[model samples]
Target: MTSTHSRARRAGFAAFVGTTIEWYDFYVYATAAALVFGPLFFPSDDPLAETAAAFATFAVAFLVRPLGGIVFGHIGDKLGRRVSLVITLLLMGVATVLVGCLPTYADIGIAAPILLIALRALQGLAVGGEWGGAVLMSVEHAPEKSKTFYGGFTQLGNPAGALLASGVFAIMSRGGETFIIDGGWRIPFIASIVLIGVGLWVRYRVEESPVFASKVEGRKQSMPLAFALRANWLPILLGIGLLPISTGGYYLATTFATAYATGETVALSEQLILDAMTVASFVEFLVTLPIAWLGDRWGRKNIMYIGLVTSVLTFAPFLLVMPGRIEPAVFLLASLVRVAMSATYAPIAAILAQMFRPQARYTSIALAYGVGAAVWAGFSPWFATQLIAWTGSVWSVIAMFTGMAVLAGICTRLAPQHSDEAPVTASFTPRTDTRTNRLP
Candidate 1:
């Protein structure tokens, strides 16, 4: 029992650190796109076009993320979670390190942005692969009574990573105007090398899943993806549906909020908005564990349902009132959005992992999550900005938020659960014979 407890601690810590590195590498690109890439790689006479071009490169990773999911899911499902996770860390680190070495447009003309896009694509692919393996490692290793709490470590990486990326740039910005505008952005991308090294070291220490260990003889699917598509497709769809609230909801709170606060309509200081996000990210990091604990005791789906409903109700008021005020109080109130996000985000690891049989859990969860990220997260921020541009109101974006919450709530209410209490079965269908595996 002590050994099992020790292993669970190691697994949770590994997931947290690995995901922190992966997300830090990914978010550094987002931060750089906003603050540096626009000026460097896509230097244009029109600032709008230049900004658009930089963001397009940022979006490229999301486009290829699903491909990464498919390829890496195959690796994790067939090869083992640890192997896929380590490879993903290496891939993301290498690409991020190369981005630091990349020549600017002035140095290499079109090849600069081309290479930038290629590196970003690699980052997307690596992260797409990384998430599933990390999530599985933690959830599968955890005690059944506390899977959500352990799983929260994976979700905890988001804000922790965002904070690191944002903090790195914030510090780098002080290195004088010439360094910042000319080349300092490379520092964060390059720093990924060190972060990945640390992640690899930590990830190496954790044991492989016993559940995965149990799959042998006739138990293992020869083609996990094929089996996932055939028998577990409903839960996969539900997973995708339930994810918009997380993937998109976060973008709404952070990226879109940044755009709205800094854009012409409100004209808040960029520094104010970024600082607010930094604070909110910290709050989210603090908030996730408690929500996950609650899920473990009460129910993962119930916590998620309440969170989605609260977010649906609060999102409009958040946009219309608090954020519009442009005060520090805005973040204090908006932190509740993070709390709402935690409801779904914290327990999602256990929830999604349990949705399908272990034979295809990695593939199904990874693919569905990749799709959700691409559509909801990758597009939602840009989409929110466009709605404001087209409709001249943030209310339209708020409506979109409400619509997503409704969809997620309905899906969560209906999703068939596969609980940690059940043994990993060869069959892809959820095991309803087990009382704990039944959806409430």
Candidate 2:
């Protein structure tokens, strides 16, 4: 390979590893909150209410992600990508480990739920900052021709983290619910410490993205959030619309499925759900890289639009296939389709990363992405479950996913085809750091 290609590959691999570690910390909670958090931390007389509360708690983390992204994006744009990554990794790892140590409702009463919310919020922030840093690192370092592929490589981290998170949960479940609630869940949370260390070691070794480096050397945005809002309001709105489709789909597919299965006894065994998720993640991992590669030849928007269409078409069948009883065949098919949507968007990091000049890309993309995710994706699982409870069918939830995906496509299409090539006249620089580094 050419030297530039090699550098991009190395950077992509490192970003991939960092993303995996970052997401691993984030997703472990999803598994726990769905399976054990309600019983352990939010114990209540009504099982149904308890589950709803647990889902709400899960959504809380997402609510805080926008602020986290704004803060981290500022740091990445102004300070450096390397520093932003380091702090984000440390924040996520520390918060996750703390969750492992938190006292349950049995021991701490109301404080248990309070602590859970705090930790979840912390996690949201950590992750909110993470995506921008990791994606920028990979996309900036990538060879111009293969940038999307590198972005896809970094995106692989999602499935990698998801697989590991699900695998851990599945293993713990095999030991029995008592074992999981008592101590098993802690294993995954505590594991974050080790991942943090690995992520830091590699992250510190890399240089900042050349694009970001050049921007910093020139003059960084003083207020990235404000600049982004003023200049790219339309992109931000479109991005937000799309966020619910993917974010909603992800949470609903993983957490909601677990809840539905466990409650109805039709959901696959914990082991089975874990296995299905693993398979889906593995498929996602395999497909994401190629999708990103394809974007390079075709266009990032081309691939994403296709994925959006797929999401719209597959929504109903995906849910309909999941019945009260776990049908391994149906489960696999549904999970694979979900994986396809994820895979299609795998290269989107590079697409979004290129949307603005390096001077403002961090803030513009970060704020837009964060707002989209927080408003749409953040509460998706909670909304879906609540809707399901209300309507007694999954049609509404499926429609929501399909609708958002279509909207995202339209919005994404509205963005300039070559954002990196776009001329700019204005920018913003943050006057002060807004990040609250408190970990749960």
Candidate 3:
């Protein structure tokens, strides 16, 4: 390959790897909250309330994500994607390591949970910034010929991160509950420091987004959120409305599956849940890359329509089959549920990022997409688990998933096609960058 091609490819891969590490730090906490934190951190006599509290803490992180997205989104739009990328990785890595070192309720009374909340909030903030920065790094640097494919490549980090987190937790859990509760959990959280160093090194070598660089040169407004809101409220709102189904399905397959299988009287083995997650992550990553390629050719909305329809038809049956079973058949079914999620996820970054001008692209996409995705995806596992417990039927969760699919489908139908959307591609011009104020 030519030197230029090689450099871009390496840059894209580096961005992808950084995304994997950032997500690994994020998902490990979610996994622990699902299985172990209720017992270890909360230490309550009432099992139900304890589980609820744990999920509440898990959900609290997402509540902070919108703010994170707005904050980092402004920095990215003004300072450049590279700067935002470095800040987010360091923030996530430090928070994760701190979580590893936190004391449990048994050791510090109520202070333990309070400290845990603070750390998790930091994590939420870091992740809020991470997605927008990573997506922009890959897609902005990507060539015009393969925009969707390269964009999806960055998103592939989500599954890779999930695989690492699940694989590590699985290996650690084998040492038995006592081992996991006592110290095994710390191993995964502690691993983030090395990952962060590697991510920082990779990100530092990449140049600023071509789009942002040019926007600066053209005397564009520095305040991206204001520019986005004033110019593109319709698409922003639509993007927000469209994300619940994609994220809701993700939580159902990963977080809720573990809880429903383990938290109930008929709890399945932790090993089984981890194995299923590993396989699902593998399949989703493999499938997402190719589907994103198709999205570039066939149109993102068209592919999304197919996915949403499939989800609407399959949601009820999938959830119905998930509980009271733990075999190869159920495993295959679970993996397919994840595949459906991957279909929507693969093209979403590019599609959403396409909605605004280059100057405001970062903030518009991050706040609208990031905030919506976190609220829908982050809280989903907890919501599904609670719904299952309250209704005593997996069908209720399935119904919820199906409803979200329909909602996303409607929004997808309304979205402007890529050719119709304004361009966000980077330019060669140079100018001063402006930092925007944070969104409310």
Candidate 4:
């Protein structure tokens, strides 16, 4: 028992650290896209067109995520989770550093945005593979009763990264928009190299997942992706359906909101939005573990339902109040919405992991999350921008947000749970018998 607890702690910490760095690298690009990428990379006469183009470059990463999942997921299912994760960290770090070094449109014209897209694509690929392995490393190592709690550690990386990214930008924006637009953004990207070194060292210190070693080490799947598609398609689809809030909704609240708040519609300062996001991220980070513990006690799906419902309710007010430029209201609403989001996001790692058997869990989860991100997260900001551009109202965005939350809630209720460990009472029960290892 002592040894198991110790191992779980080590794995959870390593997963948290690795994912935090990956997310930090990813969110920095998101921050830049909302703030500086338009003028710097994709220069345009119309501000809206420039913003749309910048978001398009941001979306490029999501396009390649499925491929990254396939490539690295295969490596994870066959070689080991630890091996794949280390490679992803290195890939993400190198790409981020290169982004910091790239010349802007003023310097290189079309080649500049083209190179930016390429680097962002690389980032998408790395993060595409990064999430599943990190979640599995923590959850698979945890004792059965504590799996959700440990899995929450993996989820922690999201807000922690967001907090770090937003906080860094908030500090830098103190130098003013002139400073940020000129060169302040590059510091975060270049500094990712140091984080990559730290992540590599921490990830190396953790052992391979005992689940993989015991069940899969000797007999590797020849084609994990094909196997996942054939046997795990239902769960994969359900997983995708269940992630609208965690994926698209999150970007809507942070990335799109930042741009909208700072754009002509709201005309708030960039620093204000960044500061609000930083506060929200910090609040979400603080509450994530407690919410995950609640999921363990009350039920994973129950907690998710609560989050989904509240997100819709809170989001409407946030949209309405944001346009008013009320500083205190903006700060309060941002944090409140993030707390609601954390309830939805924190328990999902374990829920998704348990939805598939060990044979191709890495590929299954990665593909589900990657494709979902591509459709929901990758395109959401751009879509919301276009919707506002066309309809001339933020309420269109509110309608879209509500629809996503509803979809995710339905999927969460229906998704099957399959695990090698003891069954979680609150999670969805599989209709098919566990003894036969078959899905309904």
Give the number of the best model, judged by lDDT. 4
Q: What shift in Å separates residue 392 of candidate 3 from its native position after superposition?
A: 2.1
Residue 402 error for model 2, in Å? 1.9
lDDT, model 4, position 354: 86
Q: Is candidate 1 or candidate 3 better by TM-score?
A: 1
Candidate 2 C-alpha lDDT tens digits along 1-440: 58767778778888999999977887898888778887787778877677888888888877888888889988887788889888988898889999999989989799989988998899889888888888888988876667788888778898889878988887787897578877888999988888888888988888767766654556766887776777777656655664555566666667776776666535556666677777777777778888888877776667777777776666566567666354666567656676667744685787677655566567667776777777776777778778877888778888777777767766666654343322333453222111110011
Candidate whose TM-score is highest: 4
Write candidate 1's Cα lDDT for 233-347 as tens digits: 8887888898888888877877667656655566775556666677777888888888888888878888888889887776666677644565856767567777778787888
Model 4: runs farther than 4 Å from truth? Answer: 422-440
Clashing pairs in 4: none
CA lDDT of each prediction against the hidden true structure: 0.80, 0.74, 0.75, 0.90
Among all windows of ten consecutive residues in candidate 2, which has the lowest summed lDDT?
431-440
User: How high is each candidate's TM-score?
Assistant: 0.92, 0.91, 0.91, 0.96
lDDT of 3 by residue, 1-440 (tens): 26545555765787788889987987899888887888888888877667778887887778888788889988987788888889988999999999999888889889989999999999888888888777877776666545677778777898989989988988887898678878788899998898888888888888777656754546566677787788768878888877876666776667776777676554677888788788878887789889888877776666677777666565555555656574775677767877877778887777676655566677777787666867687778777777867998777887888788888877766654232123434542122111110011
Candidate 4: C-alpha lDDT: 0.90
| Candidate 3: 10-residue stretch with minimal lDDT | 431-440
RMSD (Cα, Å) of model 4: 3.6
lDDT at residue 194 of model 4 (Cα atoms):
90
